[model samples]
Structure formats: C-alpha cells, structure tokens
Target: MAAQQPSEKILVVDAQADSAKLIVLQLQEAGFAAVWARDGEAAIGMLDGDDYSLALLDIRLPKANGIEVLSHIRESGKDTAAIMMTAHGNENLAVECMKAGCVDYLSKPFAMDDMLQRVMRAMTNRRVLLQKQRLEQEKDDFVSMLSHDMKNPLTAVIGSIDIIREGRLGTVNQEQAEYLHAAIDSCNEVIAMIDNLLDIHRFEAGRMQMKIAAYSAVEILRGGTRRFTRIAEHDGIRLRERLSHETPRIAVDKNAFSRVIANLLANSVKFTPEGGEIVVSCRCLKGAEVPWTRLPSYVTVPDGFAEKDCFVQVSIRDTGSGIPPDDLGRIFERYVQSRSGVGRERGGAGLGLAFCKMAVESCGGIIWVESEAGLGSIFVILLPCYLNGTECTGK
Candidate 1:
C-alpha cells in the first residue's frame, strides 16, 4: 500500500511568542501545515477566516483565555479538534476544559514527541470523519446521476410500447401482443425502482420538500385502490376499500401520499397468492388511540398534533403468506426483505416499504406492520388530520 499523505492544517495558540513559534516549527517539521497565534483573540479570528483540522491551545492566554476561545469554537459548530496546554496542576481545570469541548490536553514543558503524537492522533481522527462525509456525498451524487440518465430512455420505451399496444403500428398478433405487454410491465417495474432509488437518495440527503395541500382522505383511498383493482382482478385477487364517510381532509403532498399508498398496494399484490383478499381502509381516531408500538422509528407524531383530538388511520390488510417473526422488525428498512420463500419468488428491489416509511414520516405520519407467519399481514399508517379552515402545521 502507498504511504498515507499528511494534509492537516493546524492552528497553534499561546500567549508566549517564543512558545508559539517553537510549536509551529515542530509541527512543520513533522509534516503538518501550522499557523501560530500569540493570543486567544487572534486564534479565534484565524478560525473564522480559515478551515483547520485541529487547534492546539494554551490554557493561559492574554485577552479571552483558552476556555473562552474553546467555548466560542463549540458554539460556532466548527468541527475542528482542540487540544489544550495547561500548566495548572488542578485536575478540576482539566475536567472543566474537557467539558468545554477540548479533545485532549498537554502540560507546560511537555516533550516535543508527546505533543507531536497527540497532534497526529487528532488530525488522523479528523481525516477519518472527513473521508466518511465525502464518501456519503459521492454516493448521493452517483444515485442522482444514474436515476436522471435512466429516466429519459425508460420514458421513451414506455411511450413506444403504448403506441404499439394501441395498434398504431400495424396489426400485432395475440402472441406478439402478449410478449409486448410483458416487456412493458418489466419496463414499468424498472422505472418504479429507479424512482424509489431517487426518492430515498433525496430523502436521506434532506432535499425532499413536501408540497402540501388540502385533499379529501376518502378520495385518496378510493383513487389508490382503483388503480390496483384491474391488476388484482387479473391475478384472481379481490381489492376493496372501507373508507369512512366522515373522514376529514388531510393536508399533505398529494403525489407523495398517493405514491405511498401505491407502494403498499404493490407489495400486497405481489405477495398475496391467487384468489387472496386485500382491503384498504381509512378512519379518523384520537392520537391516544394509536398503537404506538406499531409505529416505526422514523415516524413521529408532530408536536402540534399531540393536543389535537383526531388523526387519520389508514390500513392495508392482506390475506396471504405473512412475514416471519424475525423479519418483521426490518421490513421497513431499505433493501431488506423477508426471508420467507414468497419474497424470494416475488423479486423486487426491496425498497417499497422503505419509501413508504419515508413518505409517510415526511407528512408527520407513522407506518408499521403487524404480521404472523402463515396467517396474514396488516400494514398501518397514521396521519394527522387537516381540520377545515385551519392550517396544517407539519411537513
């Protein structure tokens, strides 16, 4: 392996001019880029002007002192590691400095080797943290680029398939039409997967913005179920809904909410055996009536809704092979799938539930699943109701 490169820029702070110069020289000789500050005020000023990997500070300094400088650094939320130099023998002062966010400390008249070692260790840690952040950013960029590039071609292919299916391109025989339909379905699945990947990438990077508006809860439920009715019938399954007439309007990103419901329906359609039954239901309930244990970790009840009298509860229940007990806890996690044979037979990218979880939580809702092997599974979603004439408070 190639030798690691040293690239940390360090700041050395001391009231004594000679001590500061000596430390800067030592750091330079050790292959570190170092800047010297004769007082805490100068150190603070330098920090604001430049990015640094670490700061070496003396506890005794003219004007502002080391503790005050460290406190300011912490308050500013800069990720620079700090090592304090203290001549005071009191352990309490050392503890106080640590509580003030000092990463390590040194005593006056410390050996050059020990000081250099501490500096190296702190810089190494900073390098690791920076590397992690960079990798995460790169991953996000890759996913975004891939999704954008694939979408155009996929859309073109789907449009062409639609044209052919409509008999616009000469007459197609039954066999040819069947194969073309399969190809179209496969293309659509790939498009859905790409969309899911993009959604997850945006969500994790905190770029997802909710376009909230008032919408009827019953209409949403009916629309979602309607889209899957024909597909369920083709598979010899029954898709139905039990929405309450008194269901209130909900303010949410209509597209996102619809996507969540579609994903749930897709999951149920995929796993439910032929002739199985699926039900989509919605009802208004009090926050206190929600089963908190069924809520996933990502979902949170908004503070504004805590005192409210009502919330919306939606459930998609299926009578099919249920999830195994061991896999229940992880079904909502990205790329996780049940180990049951059914999941293996019905192949997917395993992102539907994860996307559902994120979309629901973004609207200040909770989603969870209750399943038992060989019985059935019930996926539940709880959303805060949008009272008429009142503005919704969450996004």
Candidate 2:
C-alpha cells in the first residue's frame, strides 16, 4: 500500500537571496507552503506576523547570526521547529547551531533529499510536542470543570441535609427520621467523593498543606473506627483493630491522616461480603527500610547513615474479592475503573483508591496494596515517627 505524504509549512531565512529563493522553490515543488525571510531580522519579523511549522535558517546572515535567531525562537517558546544550514567549511558551526536550539543541522553542500529529510524530522517533532501540550491542557480543563460541576451539587445536597436534620422545616416522625438519616449519610458519601476531586486538584497544584502534630495511633484509630463502626455494622461486616501499645506518637496531619484510614476502612467494608472480615492493624517498626528510602546502585551515600528509626505502619487488610493483577497499575489514576472480575462485581467510580493515594501522599506518607484474585487486598500506610509529641489521649 502506498503511504500518504504529509504537507508541511516551511520558513526559509538566509542572507543569500539566490540560496533562499532556490530552497523555497524546492520546498514548494515538494508541496510545502514555503515562506521566505531574507535575513535573521526579517525572519523574526515574519514570525511575529505569521505562524510556520518549521524554520530553515542559514548560519551566515545579516543583522543576526543563525544561532541568535534560533535562540530567539526558543525564548519565544513557539513550537516552530528549526533546521540550521551551515556551509561545508563551517562544520563546527553546525554543531554550535544545534546547541543553540536548532532541531536539525544541514551542511550547505547537502543534497535536496537530505534537506527534505531534516525538515520532515523537525516538523514531526514539533507536531508531536504541540499535540502533547494540547492534550495536557485539555486534561487540566476537564479536571477543573469536573471539580466545579460536581462540588456545587454536592454542596447543595449537604446543605439540604443540614436543614432537614436541624428541624428547620418541621419535626419528623420515626420513619421520616430514619430516611432523613439515610439521606444525610448518602450526602456525606457524595461530599467525600467531591472532596476527593478537590484533593486531586490540590495535589496537582502542589497545594496540599499538612498540619504536623503529635497523635496517638490507638486513639486516632479508635475515633476514626467509631465514625465508621455503624456503617460496618449496618453492612454486617466485622471491623477489627489490633494496635500495639508500644506504637509511638507519630508526626502527622491528624484530620487528613484520619481520612486516609477511614476511607480505606470504609472501602473494605463496602467491598467485603456481608460476613467478611476487615482487620485494621497499627505497629511501630524499628529500622524499617521502605522502597523509596533505598538509593540506586550507582549512588553512594556518605557516612552517618541514620538507623533504628521508627515508622508507624498501618494496614487495612480485607478478606474481600481481591483486585485483579491487570487492574492494579491504573487503579490510582483519577476516574479509572477496573473492568474485569470483582470490580464489575462491585460498582464504583474507581475514585476511592485515587483519593486514598492523594490523601496518603499529601500527608508525607505512602499507600499501596497487596492483593490477589479471590484472596483479599491489604492497603498499607507508613508515616514517620514523632518523638515526645503531645498525645491525643482523647478526652
């Protein structure tokens, strides 16, 4: 099969009128839209007036050197790729041109075929870069729109719930009260999901602020667990916790960290079969070396390696239908869903893991999972230990 040829726009800048005209004629003959710039100054003027996909520059020019013109193009941040032309006697000039930001260098004595090849390669690179930038901008726009659209309705629903709960309308009967409570709970869940979206925006914007303070492992777990204990009971799932008494006071953003643990616990209960077990465990580890702490082989550490440090490792291991191996990598991406197996068994927007990931990373910690199909999944979090911080003995 014959391949389709791509049409390109080319800009030619040269001091030699004959050389520039000849190249432009060749490019046009090859079906390129060729724009001519008589000198470096003229090239900059042309760029200011019009957009071109690629620019072919001559190293020797009036008013500005090709390198200077290339530097200007780069500084302008245009996606216009550049090919610098150098006379055969100025081979070193070609290398210098490349260093100055020309995408390709063509020696003056080069064949028309070689010139075309370099121009095509440069244009291809420019096109790819521009496309990537456009896609990223679209992604950012979508996230922003999603955040606003989703949060507004969720805020309204929560506000309505508050009004209903406060008896602003009227007194409620037992059945109405039950239904209102359920409505409030549902509203809270949606609010949490919307908060997840806000968390993503904050994390991406590098705006996640953590308030570091001393907190007790058992106490935080107890309060967080109590909040969700009713939900676990309503679903007939067992929420068990085993905390080490020796678990030291850790430096953490208490409220945010509590959300991390509570989200995981809630997910465990939601996914587990009615009678399944969800175990929450916290222990202080001494000399625990996690993956991120390890230096690559080529890196050598100077002396005074601190050891015997403390880290509070918390795990929410659920005996639920586990995550499939294929869906593991993408589980943390925003709005990404696991399509196969158990993910289909349980319907969700797949935002929980993404939320969990953002929350964990925001608190200067890490969260990951260990799971196998049909076995279970265990989500683990590790936080740095705090020494002699005020304990939350929970009044």
* Candidate closest to the true structure, highest TM-score: 1
Give one digit per residue, the lDDT tens place, for model 2 in 259-357. Answer: 777778867876688888888899976544544453223222223222325677888898888888876667777887655454355446667778777
List runs of model 2 lying over 4 Å from the truth. Answer: 1-9, 29-33, 38-42, 60-63, 88-102, 117-121, 124-128, 187-191, 194-223, 240-259, 288-308, 323-346, 358-364, 371-376, 388-395
Give lDDT tens digits, candidate 1, residues 1-395: 12235556889999888888999988888777898998989999999998788899888889878888899889999988999998858557867898878888888888998998888777777779889989988997788777778877988998999899878999988878767876776787788788888898889979988898788878988998888887788678999889998987887789989888888898888888898999999998876786666565544566765666678889999997899988888888999988877647768998988899899888777788888987879999877778783543333
Off by over 4 Å in 1: 1-9, 33-35, 40-52, 59-81, 87-102, 107-109, 173-175, 286-308, 389-395
How far residue 43's Cα lies from its native spot in candidate 2, in Å, is: 3.2
**lDDT of candidate 2?**
0.75
Taking all chains together, each candidate's TM-score versus the true structure is 0.83, 0.74
Question: After TM-score superposition, what is the CA distance of residue 389 in candidate 2 from its true location, in Å?
Answer: 8.6
Candidate 1 local distance difference test against the native: 0.83
